[model samples]
Target: MIASVTNAATLESAFNAFNEQSALLESSYRELQQQVASLTARLDEAQSARHRELLAKERLSEQLANTLEALPGAVVVLDCHGVISECNAEAARLLNQPLLDRPWSEVAKREFAPVDNADGELQLHDGRVLSLQRRRLGRDLGEILLLTDVSETRRMTEMLARQQRLSAIGEMTARLAHQIRTPLASALLYASQMSPGDCSDASPGGKVVARLRELDRMVADMLQFASGSNQDDEGIDVALLLADVAETGSLPMEAASRVAVNIADSNLRIAGNRGALKGALLNLLDNALIASGDEGRVDLGAWRDADRICLTVSDNGCGIPENELGRVFEPFFTTRPQGTGLGLAVVRSVVDAHQGEVVLESGSQGTTVSLCLPAAAIPSAQRAPERGFCHA
Candidate 1:
């Protein structure tokens, strides 16, 4: 009986301990569940935040790509190996081809012509001037190059400089003209008096008179060139202009027979100084005649091209030397021994004053000079004289 009671007591005590441990275990399990739920919520939040960040980065990357494409100037990126790694559309357009993976040196050699005495300034085969700017991307990365087209700016700068030089020359010539004309006139008068008897070109007195007259003409040309063209907004008739130039040119009979005039529209008119235009045309006609010689043909054509008047003087004879063509319009530059060297310069000044452009083209066959000027409308009341294109 005693042993049975002791066994029951031990069993009951064990049962109570087991109940207390089970309750403690349940409470701990609930606490663990709560911690797991909190962690899961935090994880979800972190994932959401990360997704938002990724989207924002993607958007930023797209924006940067669009911006690069929208840039007007070229943006080229080179790898450490000096190969074109990436480039904008403008880079391809300016370089005139695809630029990815090509070596920069090869592309430069093929497409770019380095400007003499100009660092970082290069010219394309198409005659575009590009100003290149370079920057290092970072350590061991590569380089970034930015190229901007500067052809028009360069042309304007050169034009301005030339105008300044011409202005200075004009100022100096004005002073010299006064000093030289009086003595030149006195010498001409004395030469004329001495040459009263024999006036042939072969005679000594005649030669003196001829040389003096030539000098006088040269002085007159100098004064006229220095004066430049007046800003006269008079309407000039093209037909009448050509006729007057033909008459004034006074080409020899043999040379005159080879001249041909083609006027697309008889009513074509231009707004400029009449005398200046006429003088310029006469000079070109004279030059074309001289180039064509008596056996060759010269063509003078005028027509309305777009909003401009297109005039061309072409000849079939020995063309100007390619090397000398660049300096033909420069004052005091000439290949002819007796050339005044101011004829073409005067032509240029006159055209510039009228806001016109002149271009010279020459090859082995012949030479042609083209002039473009803004066309003008004739007044409603002023009727253009009737005329037809003629061949001389």
Candidate 2:
């Protein structure tokens, strides 16, 4: 009976140990499940952030595409391999392509040349001229090409060349006139002294002499307008410049007696060749007076703006045609019966030398010439003469 009791106690102890180990295992499995849930939540949050970043990148790319497409000038974007990635509408028009994704040589075969320099002006095979500007897109990306059509600019250049030629011819004509005037005048005086008895029955010398006299006067005026010799580099008061031009070039008091000259006491100053400025102002005043004719009004004035001076000569005369307005500043261009056509041209040249600009506004009512010049320094310095002005 004692042996049987001992065996039963030993079995009971083994059963209790087994039950405790099973409970401990169950608790460990629950803790492991909780740790797995926490890790899964963190992974899910990271994925959401990654997705948002990808979406933002896509939006930015779309915006960039839209902006490139809307630009006015031709724009071409290239990849690192020098392959074209995208092009704008203007690029398509310039290259004559509906779309461009191939290599630049394939798309702009006729237009592409070895990019010799960073940027330059080039003429296409199709007779189109463009100013090409290039910039690196990023640290390692390819470059961007910006092409600006300069065909109109070339046309204007040709027009300016023609005008310059005409002006040179006018000046030559004036010099020739001056050279012949003295002799021609003497011949006319001698012919006038001769009587009918000394000449033949036809009296041809008298008629010839009369024509020569008229030619001499025309030549003198031509030389005066063409010489453009009065432009000497000197400091000039804006108000005094206009006043002197009026006193010198204005029509006789008897002819345009009603014309008025008004000057403002703005004390504006210009650092320029005095002769050039004076001549330009005089031409402007003359144009105003001639346009107004007798009984018309001409107003001359000047004022100061921040770091600049504005001089204006206005007239109540016949205005210019719209089409001709663009050509007025061109050399040897005129609408007058006896005009040498260099008045405004000389004016523009002079103003340009002073680093200034001349704006012309003409209409049916009248015309106004505005000259904007950079103000001279408060304490002036002596400087060398400037080259003649060239306006584009």
Candidate 3:
């Protein structure tokens, strides 16, 4: 009996130890199941966030597309490979095609060169001119294109250049007048003293004398137009100039008198060759009056801002068309049947001599001419004298 109890006690101890180990294993399995569930929950949350992010990205992409499409200037989105991914309305109009997925090469082939910016001017196949610009987003985002029509700008630039050229010619003519005037005048005076009968009917001397007389008259007229030395360089009140122009042109007296003169301030003064300025202003005024015909209005005005003074002459005349505006200032270029075409040319020369600039703005309603001049420097030792008066 004693041996049997010992064996049973040993077996009971073994069974208890086995039971503890099994319970420990069950506890470990439960803990593992909880950890697995937590891991699964975290994975689902990440997936959900990712899906939300994708949807938000899609919405943002749509918004960006709509924004780009609505831009006024030409908008083009290029890929990293320089291929066009999308284009806006303006771009389509400029390229003359709806380039949804077309490559940049295809559009470029149609005469639009890739420019660094849209500020540069371009000529199209259909004779249309445009200015192009590009904005690079980043190395990965490619570029955006903006196109603006610059036909008007180009026209104005051409006109300015022509005016400059004419001004140069006028200067040359002035110099020529001085050089040739004395000799021609002497020749004509001597020729005139001798009657036509003094020389043989077909004498070369007689013919030469007649020609010299003609040349003398031409030189005098040229001298009158070309030499600004005769003009007094002094500070003059702008109001006087405008008033003189209005009165002299009879713009205020005409039955249809639609012209008005304005001066920003009575104290506004400019240091310039008065005669030359007057002549220039008068020429411009005459053109404006003529352009207005018998019924339109002309406006003469002056204003000062900072260190610059601007004189403006505007007229409700037949406006210059876009294409013809460029050639208007060109020497001998005239749109009218009897236009000398030298009026604006001479005006530009005078302005340039005064170290000033002339700008033209024309549209359907009328044309405006603006003359911008730099303020005169005050003498370090002398206070500027008061503005003087002129006949205008």
Candidate 4:
């Protein structure tokens, strides 16, 4: 009976210990559940924030795309190889073709002839003008070109300039009238004396005729200056044009022989009015000859440089005075008593029409006049025509 009693007590004690262990395990499980719930809540908030960020990014991207499309200028995105990758509607219109995956050269690159140093523009084959700019991709993925149509701007500017020039010309014409009257009076007086029946003094009839011819030349020059190039539609070979210059450039063949012609490309040519060009060059050559006086040699050369044909006339003579150099190109300004002062002015006008530049450099050693003419629409074997240039 005592043994049975002891066994029952032992079992009770064991049950009690088991109950205590179960209670501790239940408490730990509760803490673990709380921790897991907190972590899940934090994760949910993070996911919500991430979703909102993604939506904002998508909206920003859409806005940027819309802005680029709506811009007035043409936007062309080019690949690293300079190939067109994407373009806006304006770009398509300006290029007049699909530009994707095409090389840059396929696009028109002809620049509009600039009126001054500040104007920047390009010309299309159809004669439209555009202003262009470029932006490089940040990581060097490619480039973005922005082109704006500037034809209307240019046209307005030219019209205004034309009006101003007309006003100036009108004033100059009045002065020219006075100049003409004096010469006409002198020629008439000379002609009256040398008439066939009423001859007086020892002045030969040839003198009267020469005076008349001088008047004719002056009229012709004025007419040419007033109306530049009757029609600049003819294309003339550079080589042949130089040969013509050698013939018409007032220097005697022996004096002309002293002019050395230097040009590497024979096939180069220019589109222009040949007669007007010859007349302009003749004036330059005559001036150079007079400066050289009958002794020193004048060097004339034409050569290709990049996209331009450089025609240069150099004289080893008493150079123009430094103070007077600035006035060399001014109309009606001359150092020679018999000079009308329109020679260089005519040269500049012709070059301006051809979209070229005239540069004059002088010092005690000599004077050099350089004409930079843009190469013709012809290929790179290329270039132009100028008055002082001659061929052997």
Error (Å) of candidate 4 at residue 19 is: 99
Residues 280-366 of candidate 3: C-alpha lDDT, one tens digit per residue: 787777778778777887888888778878889999887888998877765567787755566676677678877888999999899
lDDT at 292, model 2: 83
Mind giving the per-residue lDDT tens digits that candidate 1 earns over 1-392? 99999999999999999999999999999999999999999999999999999999999999999999999899999998999999999999989685799999989998986658446688998888998999999998999999999999998998888778768878887889889889989987898788677656577876786687667656766666888776599988887788777765543445556777778678888999888877777678878878888688878878778999977888988899877989899876777899978888888888998899998999889998887889999777776565667656
Question: Which clashing pairs does model 4 show?
Answer: 281-387
Candidate 2: which stretches are off by over 4 Å?
1-232, 378-392
Query: How does each model score on TM-score?
Result: 0.68, 0.45, 0.43, 0.44
* Better-scoring candidate (TM-score), 3 or 4: 4
Candidate 1 minimal-lDDT segment of 10 residues: 247-256
List all candidate RMSDs to the true structure: 6.3, 14.3, 12.3, 16.2
Write candidate 4's Cα lDDT for 1-392 as tens digits.
99999999999999999999898888889988999999899999999999999999999989988988899988999889899999888788777675788887666442234333355667665667878898899676989899998888888997688657745765675568567767777776777666676343334664565456556555546556666545486776666766667655533444655555655666666677777766666667667877887777666666777888766778888899987998887667799898887778778877787778888999888888887777666655443333343355
In terms of lDDT, the best-performing candidate is 1
Candidate 3 structure lDDT: 0.73
1 versus 4: better lDDT goes to:
1
Error of 4 at 127 (Å): 44
**How do the candidates rank by TM-score, highest first?**
1, 2, 4, 3
**Predicted structure 4, TM vs. truth:** 0.44
